[model samples]
Target chain A: MMLHNALDRYHDRPSSIHDLDPRVKVVVTLLGIFSVLLLPDGAWGAYFLVWCAVLAVALVARLGVGLVLRRSLVALPFALVAITLVFTLPGRTLFTLQLGAWEISASDAGLVRFSSVLVRSWLSVQMAILLVATTRIPDLLHALRHLHVPALLVTILAFMVRYLAVLLDEVTRLLRARQARSAASAQGKAGGSLLWRARVAGNMTGQLFLRSLERSDRIYNAMVARGFRGQYVTINPHRMRRRDWMALGLAFAALTMIQWLGRTLS
Target chain B: MNIALLTRLWEEVVVPRMHIPDGFLSMPVALIFWVITVALLLLAIRKTQQQLGERQIPLMGVMAAFIFAAQMINFPIAGGTSGHLLGGVLAAVMLGPWAGMLVMACVIIVQGLLFQDGGLLVMGANIFNMGLVTAALGSLYHGLAARQSKGVRLVVAGVLAWLSVVAGALFTALQLGFSGTSPFAIVVPAMLGVHMLIGIGEGLITMAALAFVMQVRPDLVAAEAVRTGGGRGWVIVGLVIALFVAVLSPIASADPDGLERVAIDMGFEEVAMTPPYELFPDYVIPFLGETPLSTILAGVIGALVVALVAFAVGRLLRQRAAAA
Candidate 1:
């Protein structure tokens, strides 16, 4: 929930990071992800160095460690699943234990693979956290459009972000009504069958969809009344400032230094 | 069966956990998913324009908001791995297939952009696998179910939903397999095998939801108008059969996911690349190295975060709409 609060806090901010063009951020983020993944497996030193570099950027962006840590935990399951490769894998076993019919073994190779995945995942998640923390959802979509992401995709995303709140409110209202009716009914009767309850829930979801469909029609009419066409036009075009270039340059420089150090050290 | 089971599934299983971290997949794989997602979006938009009138705009938005919030309520599953209703099928069942695809596409995009749930580059892949496939397949299943008995309809919806989720995972696995990290022989079986179990939970939830919807709001079933013969039945059946093939696709290799397979194959899975500052080992936990506790803490935290963010965003957008 705190993570959600943090997202809300940054959603409307016009910070320096937020000010950068979405296209630039997309490119930088993509490159950063690619470069991080490209680190040869077992490149622990390089991985740590890259992590520090990303951490530095996060600090500069004014994103707190608490926020980053909270967000990073989102990726932990995948990291754990990936780490299982070390133990489940078959090869020369470093350690083996027997439990009934199953023999659990850990492979040295699997350990290296697990660590490599953890490092890469950590680096990538940090970059993503930084991106979301800095940019507004709408701005990011616009940036994607300018960067040559398909117009249709951008439009779909825009509508999604735009209406996400409305549906949530409707759902909350529906739930409240359902709870009230259910409580009142329960007081009068032993309560409905499981099937009856499920059917009611299904009906609620179905009604929600139907209402949404009608609402979509109304929204379209409103758009047309406002002289809207099918094409989506941005209200404000994102312009990359000199500071954006400087930031990009700094990032590249840091990446280069890490790569150089990694090469020399290895 | 009971409210507790439903609540458990909604709270623990069917929510979008956004588990696969960024930088896990290769660039080529990411690019491929991106391309597929974009293409599907364009097609869905055009289809929406052709099928529905302007009313679809606000409708799509609200549906998206609903999905965003709905994702917060995950249902518990076996083996610590939970599942959530992607709602792609449910959306398609109500809004028509094309419209459902667009709604799902939007949800995934926003999640990637605002929540950082999936990477930007990989958004395309996520959409195609999660949205397009689920919507298309769900629509097909519903069509076939309509032709059969009411009992069969629920069963069909549940099975189709389960298949779609597994298929989506398989597609991702195939993408990773093609990148040369792991061969299909290893990845396909593992990913599909686990997700197959996960899909059972998906099917049960979907079936229950569909059954409830049919009982109360039969009119909302998008296919209701067309199902009374007029050759529409055949079309629906055809679509379902087509989707079956799409989901059962043999394209996926048997390789493990990119990061795990690569790490295992390359021989460097253990070298821990510690972050510069040791602020929190198990970030979601009070202390470091407590994985189970941390994971649970993280899941609860994640669910709350998604719900709040979605609620606040919905309220803000409602205000904007009213003001406009």
Candidate 2:
């Protein structure tokens, strides 16, 4: 239950962003990300404007700006992999440091590229986090289905999200069982060789797989008894209201203006 | 443990954690992969739909959920480190390749959209590298070892699982290099170095999991369904080889130091200098001028052309085989 809450970060606060059509939200989020991606490296003015737009959306959603900023840090670790660009890209050398025998110099161009990557990914993640926080998972999946993503793929996504909590609970209990059985030393470390621990985890994974499969079978039997077919029926008809269209138009205008600003600034 | 240390451990020590976030790739590179991933996804849908019955849909869905949850079980590795299962190969063996690809795609998509673990635009690359490549290799090797003894099949699964991880990492490195986000010489080695070790964990876990499944619900594993005919097997092999050659061609051309050194050693350097016309001279489009972007563009065009030609040749060979 704690894990479920932890995973589902959606806050049920009534706000303009949450009330927008999920499909429009998905499209606008994607448009924001694409604009961020398309902005040239080192476009500081455009980057600032985009951040402003993102913050504006966060404010509208009533999600604290600090929370979104903190959550966006998840993209940083992966961005660190691009650190090599600082030394490898050709440009005027910014500085040089002696690393044992080799002298490494960071290029000005490389620094710009690397920092822009960090900024772009950071901003993009904020948009994504805001989308997920505002829209419920099922609504988002429905939006995806309506957006012409593959039907089977959408169905599978639906089921996965549906059962993620149940399976995660099962995994939690399994981990608990393992912990109870694991013998702790004076240092409070579980007593096992590396291979033993790996084998134990693998067995648990395998056990989980078997249990999930059997559960699916039972689910299928129950569905069949209820005259369930392969297709899923949508209870609520999704229609984009006037405000949804207005929001979409506003987003496109804003993205265009931001892009134009980027070009003009550069 | 404190939250900071836990977060650090989660970020750093996780093995084979190569979900490419946004802004890491160039626009063209990301768009190309999006095209490739979508094409393959459509194909997977068609193939799975044709073969899968109504009951299998729920099974596929639950199995996707299983892969997501199973990723949480971190197996202890050396030096107090831990690794987790990606489960691409396991899913392929369990649900067969086409359905398995769907499962992996679903997990990657949800991770991107909900968890922000990956970027939305670069998701195509993420799904391609982690989902399509792993499932294809898993099915290829598993189908090859299908009729063998259980021990042999397990060994194949373990080795192929390891190979799949390395292969995914290699492609990620290639994509980064092509996008000009990172230099090829550095990123390739770094990515491969980490994944090569992590892959052993993948191998062990895959083997252990397969063995466990074999012992318990023997009927659940779909090894029989994965086995393909001789022609289809050749097509897969041919496509893989073509893909390898296409991916490697640009790198080979870019660094011909070995051949150049050989020419000098043989006293043929002077003789080799004359009569060749300039086509993509120095791997740059002449009109676009000398820039990294132009070189990357030229390289993409070159790779695409080679892959297309090889695909045509393979298609012709397949047609001939069918005619015979």
- Top model by DockQ, which number? 2
Q: Write the per-residue lDDT of candidate 2 for residues B122-203, one digit (tens) a residue.
A: 9999999889888876775443555557887787678668767767877887777666676554555456556756777888
lDDT tens readout by residue for model 1, A216-257: 677778888988765478779677788878878877887777
- lDDT by residue (B33-81, candidate 1, tens digit) is 7776767677767766767654456566667767765654333343455
Residue by residue across A10-110, what tens digits does model 2's lDDT show? 55788999999999999999999999999988899999999998899999888878978988888787765778777766678899877544567777887
What's the alpha carbon RMSD for model 2?
A: 9.1
In CAPRI terms, model 2 is classed as acceptable
Q: What is the C-alpha DockQ of each candidate?
A: 0.25, 0.46
Interface RMSD of each: 8.6, 7.0
Question: Taking chain A of candidate 2, what TM-score results?
Answer: 0.94
Per-chain TM-score (chain B), model 1: 0.65
Off-target runs (Cα >4 Å) in candidate 1 are: A1-5, A11-15, A88-93, A172-200, A221-225, A256-264, B1-19, B49-53, B73-84, B142-155, B172-194, B197-201, B204-324
